[model samples]
Target: MRLTGPAGLATRAVLAAAISGMVLAGSFAIVAVMAVAGGMILSAYGSDLLGFVRITPPQMFWPIVWLLCALGATGLFVRAIVRIIRTERAAFLERTTPLSETTMAETSYIDSSAERLARQVGIATPTVRIDSTATPLAYTTYRPDTSIINADRDETPVIVLSTGLIETLSQSELSAVLAHEIGHIANDDLRLISVLLMPLIAAETLTEDEGRTSNVFELCGHHLSFIALIGVGIFSRGRELAADRAAAVMTGEPAALAGALETLDESATPKPTADLRDHARSTNAINVLPTLGPANSGTGPRSTHPSLETRLEQLRSLARG
Candidate 1:
């Protein structure tokens, strides 16, 4: 009923390649046409309007321009991914303090538990951190290890648990939460998420949808954003399910995770304000629990994670097995 393993990987790969190819071809065509037309226009009026700046097509302009653009875009995309990870972590750190091993012995225990869970899920121990947020949430992020530069040093992912979450769940439930986060690290979902966001980032740059923009640009961005959002939703939902399965297998306690989820599910209240709703939508992709009012309530492209009911069903199935 669900796509997992090699079949799912192949499906996602094909879809991602198709979408990326379409976007690249469209961008290249647009840029090439604009460049050629601009050159022609300048050449036509240069003598009369502006004599100082000579406008002429460079030798092998098409190849040179396209090659440069391809390389620049690739480099920028990679850099953007790194910066995004750092920036998000910085923002979260700004709002809260790190967990102190000396003062908080309980958190220290949780940290050790997280390390064991990470190994169980087949990943290096992720750096464990804590946030002061009252919301019961846990999430993970990762970057490549740079200790040896060229060598792969088993980059540790980061696992963050809110203080509220720690206070809320029992020890077994906390272990389940850690297992779920370790599932994300083991899956390399942070990289997958960055890949899914690239098109939306490109769209935002072209259209400036976050700020005021011309009507035409706004319209173009709307369409592009919609497409990107749909892609993200589909891709992310699968990841959540995969992580749930991994957590279940690693902990051999899908029931514990299910109970933890149900406990958190009780905390879901109707988001009354626009800002709250927007925040929920934005974080849903990363958070262990979706914050968009209720799970499976919204339809279509807006839903980032699958419904709690759906996730619980999966967990229950694993537990039964």
Candidate 2:
């Protein structure tokens, strides 16, 4: 799918929060452990130097308190990392499901269309897959196949379009949508986005493991790793908008892309109030919209794409020229 501005921003924000949470947990652990260690050292040696190496009540009480707090923070961090993994896994599963029963016939039609378009555009044909969800969406995926790899040939990219999206748009509009995704491939935007976000993913995984460790030193390290993840979230939204623009240019039919946006807007289902509230809390963002916005308007901190109205406006503007 075209990474709309809001979607990119949301992704970056999630990465950032993961990083921040990890860093905070790590810092708390380190400080707590150091305090505990210092207390123990003083209790062990202070009496010897002063000829009264006796364990005092206050000294013993404070070390235990510090250790307890450190353990609690570590638990909290572990929980947060587990939460991130579950959410990420769900999203990945949704994207990678094999196009089997969802829309076999519709997928075949689109795959045919994509091959035609590929030939027309003078690019190698891409294998197309369909996702059955009614939510209008499309995206391109590329992987280097070792079996097919040759020193003289470039690895091929794969394209996927949702059957719901194909049914929603006209033939011309579908072509425009395909072109937009193709633009991503042409610009190597997918690889770029993946590479840019890899650090955040790694940090997230690290925090997940380290946060679980009981050692105060390891727990402290988990919190320190999240700063980079937060940085990833802040910038992701802008990149999505850029990709949309790239798609429009590649298709040379801004109105078709605009129409596609309108179709997605209509297809979106309403989210329940409880779900919206839950999302807000989980994401730690204020004024987040319940639905994905169109290309141009209604963007918020948590939105993954721009509003439909805004996207349509840009498309119409381009079409007029």
Candidate 3:
């Protein structure tokens, strides 16, 4: 397979998978602990569980408190899992125009770019899509593998571009953006980000209404989500830079991407592509640019992407090389 970046897409994807596994497991463990703790605490007071091992005052007190925490965490974990299984979609998504339904207006410009770039990357052309929104946006989202397994059972990735993006960028610059997104598919980034984001989504959903009333176990799960978020952020930035390199190498036009990044940030009136209340973290993880403002955007280690200047410099370096 063709390598996409310094360590190659396979290697980077492996790292992201490993991190995702850890995050998933860690969050579950916290919930399991919460369950155990909660059971022990409940048993201590009035329940019959563990009443056989009648440990004395102070020692029993600490154990009881710990047990309650574990019990609560476990409950939250189960609820989250159930919700995920039932809902299927990890998070709410904005509507996107699918390939068959895509209008002819800008199809020539966007689809042709995607078709050409996918060929260069040796991947099947993805379903290029448009989101009917005013905000400039670009992101890759996963499609579930529902059809009977064939030799080509690969879940087709979707590249979504906002109306504002199409209106704002020149064809070359938009092509660069398309190349960058196609690079994500070439590098297996869509699945990686989706897997890495599970815990964060679970945490947010778990605490959506809890507010101050959230218990220690819930808090633990929330805190563990941060670790997952950080992991996602680091790998996300790596993939972003790698995709930049891939775009430049594939298109032989790093300046085009650099210019697109500049124009997106320098927009006279920047509109958010995702609701900060519900979807900012989700969108920011995979969007071309972090939809949230800088405070919570992918500008830092805690967010999903690197700074605009960082990405621009990467393309500049690629161009120079």
Candidate 4:
């Protein structure tokens, strides 16, 4: 079946859920085994406690301990991973200080155009920032309002455009890109993506140290990371398509988006000798355009974004309509 409509989305959602469940179950199994093993060690040593402090409970309490431990570990993992990502983003912005909001604010033309487009998209004019990188890139992020202490307010979305993108794309193409990002914000995709990343983040923590897997529990946890990545990829691809459709409708310029994608595809084509593997991977993971260069040819299956050809074809269909 050609799964690309509501049915396809449902199927992908189901697959993501199944994969997530498998990963969680595997993780719980590991925790249970470790809890049991620790209990056995304590019992063998005739110790009525754990770590020589907390009193060890009966066999029935081991399961409760495992659940609590797993929950605690998962919570910490999510917090740590989110913090790390935030730290890295902050560091990048700091290092590229010349491209900050104050710097871009001086560019009245871009600011005006973005404001106009933001109105057309039916959302607040997002704070616009520029990145000094030569590689063409654009993305959006949402930071919830922190002013009211605990107000149930919407997030303040920010749209970031790279220097290369500003210099390369035509005005219409640029507008199309911004529209796509606005679509992401309007759909509350950032929150959805953050929630989806929890399982993957936990899996990533478990697999961080390759040599740390000393037992079956660790091994299973490590393997579950790959499964979580698969689920992540599935949902990400669908989200990208949804964003594309939103952009096309909002901009009434599907062809412009296609043109922008074509240009980015050319820029992303890796040089034979350039070590852009990591950059390409990151770009494909988050950027609006998939860097379909020579360095990433074999990523057809694992890529977070759909193929350039696929995206272009979809846009072309939109254009025809």
Candidate 5:
């Protein structure tokens, strides 16, 4: 689950290459814009404008300005996403009830299973919370960036479950779900996906405020972000498959996980346009069950998780073997 072997190396390479690709794409996009803009200016004003003095040591001022602008936009892009992450997480937390207030009497197995599975994998037992809302939902969260001086992130990742999920699933099925989430914790899927999400969020921001773009630098950032989003899509789906596989292995009950998935699939009838909980839509990537009907199996780079069919097929294979 932690990404080892040739598969691990390949995943690391993909991640590194994706980030590098964004940087290169941004640089090239900016350069191309500069080239086009220069050509237009030269054509319009003729050689007379060239007399304004090109090619002085300090005359590289425009280039430096462009570089600084690009850097500034990058900082802004990152900052915007950081705010978004914090806000969505806050919204999610606000809507969910803590475990202390919930029916803990019914969930003793939840703690035991989480502790045992996490310990088996040498990870700290994740903190589990309950959402009172009845819409079936489940996800894991890791706050590695929560606090630099006193972060207990690796030691205390979180798993959130809705009362709907608890009431809907049997104990064994819930254990399978817990095992699956622990797989995500062990694999560090949340943080890794968060990295991949950066460019997409930047691109999304640009789309929302497209008219605000007054320069080429911002345009370059948009282009590179869309480019990086493709890689993110590919990796996102792969992580789901990895987590599922890890869950099956860890629990030694591919069928139980499979049954849980089937139950969730049945209840997921017609994805809601607006979930009862705020920001629930945004939390899909980390959720145990996705919102849409997409059966994407990492075959399409645009998908975030494997479809139910794809996942069930794998679990069925494991069961057969």
Candidate 6:
């Protein structure tokens, strides 16, 4: 589902809850185990002062203590494993494939066009990078640079486009795509999404374990993480539509932006099974639902982009005006 507007906000809230819940649960488990171990140690050592104290054998005492400690450590480790798994899954879901280095040169040809468009929109020129990926994708990154735009010298924006996108779109549509990515930079949407997702990413990294079994608790955690990731995915889709709108406004060519969306929609072909659709929905940037044919289709609440038809209709409306 699209992650913009009210829906996006709700999804972010869910993601926050998932991350917080994992951390809290892990900590509580560790504390409980430690408390139990401490009590056992005291009893074995005859430290009770109520009335009568009983002492245990040295061999038994040492082994029990060791076992308690081992158990506590094991619990903590398992919690960490769960957290890491969730985080990785979230990151994977959000990751947009970078354009390949091979196609960077060709995609870089649009840099001049992007610069001109930025000027028209009253934003400073952003550094543009091109990737060689076959997927028609684009994203922007910000870096601290000693460059002045309207006397601000803190953060500079960099826009990256995929060569596949460049090859797929006509010149007018390419400008619209560039404008859309530039809109992301202008609105600082990229930074917001990154910050919101950092905790979940950290949690996933902490809980990852290669050899650990997927126990009931871990499996439940994974499902929560997956839901949270879906929320993030929804948020991302909304941002995409917003960017499209921004692109249309900046270029004053709604049809061009609409065309670009249609191109992307067409490229996202479906695989064979429902399982693959779920996998693609979770893992792929492009949604592969059957209804979205090359011409037009309605995007549901969960879509990252508006329906191709909806976007085209909006463009046509703008063009008519």
Model 6 per-residue lDDT tens digits across residues 1-321: 121333454555456445545654654465467656765776655544522545434656655765676577667755654454344344333333333334444445476787787776567787665544455555565432212112243355666565556787888888887888777666656555544343334334333452343664444344444444444445555555666667777888988887777776676564224333232222233322222233223344334345556557766877887
Instruction: Give candidate 5's whole-model lDDT.
Output: 0.67
Per-residue error for 125 in candidate 1, Å, reads: 0.5
lDDT value for model 2: 0.51
Model 1 lDDT tens row, 1-321: 121443585576457546644654554454455555555555556444544565455556545555665566556655654565445445544544556642554776787887787666556777877776667768875432332112243666567787768888888888888888777767667666756655554555456535555775466555665566667676777778888887788788999999998888786554335434223233556788875556433265546677778889989988888
Top of the candidates by lDDT = 3
User: What does the lDDT read for residue 154 in candidate 5?
Assistant: 49
User: What would the TM-scores of all predictions be?
Assistant: 0.74, 0.52, 0.77, 0.73, 0.74, 0.57
Error of 4 at 118 (Å): 3.0
Clash counts for all predictions: 0, 33, 13, 0, 0, 20
- Alpha-carbon RMSD, each predicted model: 5.1, 10.0, 5.8, 5.7, 5.7, 9.0
Winner on TM-score between 4 and 5 is: 5
User: lDDT by residue for model 2 over 130-183, one digit each (tens)?
Assistant: 655554556654443212112122656656565557787887777777776665
Candidate 5 per-residue lDDT, tens place, 1-321, comes to 263322763565387456746664665455555655665454446435554767233555455555665566556555665776665556566666667667655577887899999987888788888877666788876443463223345457678898878888988889899988888778776666656555555454445444455565567556655566566656666677777888888899999999999998787676554663345334655678765455432445555667778889999999998
Best-to-worst ranking by lDDT? 3, 5, 1, 4, 6, 2
Query: In model 6, what is the error at residue 178, expressed in angstroms?
Result: 1.0
RMSD of 5: 5.7
**Model 3 Cα lDDT, one tens digit per residue, 225-312:** 6677777776787888888888888889999999998898776245553434445446767778877666545455676777777888
Q: Which residue runs of candidate 2 sit more than 4 Å off their true CA positions? A: 1-109, 119-123, 142-153, 199-236, 271-298, 301-303
Please write out the lDDT profile of model 4 over residues 1-321, one tens digit for every residue. 111234576677678767777776666666656655665564556544464786665776655654665566656554665664454345334423323344443467667766776676566777777767676768764442222122123556567677767888888888888877777766656555545555565554455466588766457656775677677678777778878888888778899989988887787556323323324233344568654453332254455677667788999998888
- Cα lDDT computed for each candidate against the true fold: 0.64, 0.51, 0.70, 0.63, 0.67, 0.54
Assess the local accuracy of residue 275 in candidate 3 as a C-alpha lDDT between 0 and 100: 33
Measured with C-alpha atoms, the lDDT of residue 201 in candidate 5 is 50
User: Which number leads on TM-score?
Assistant: 3
Q: What's the true lDDT of residue 320 in model 6?
A: 89
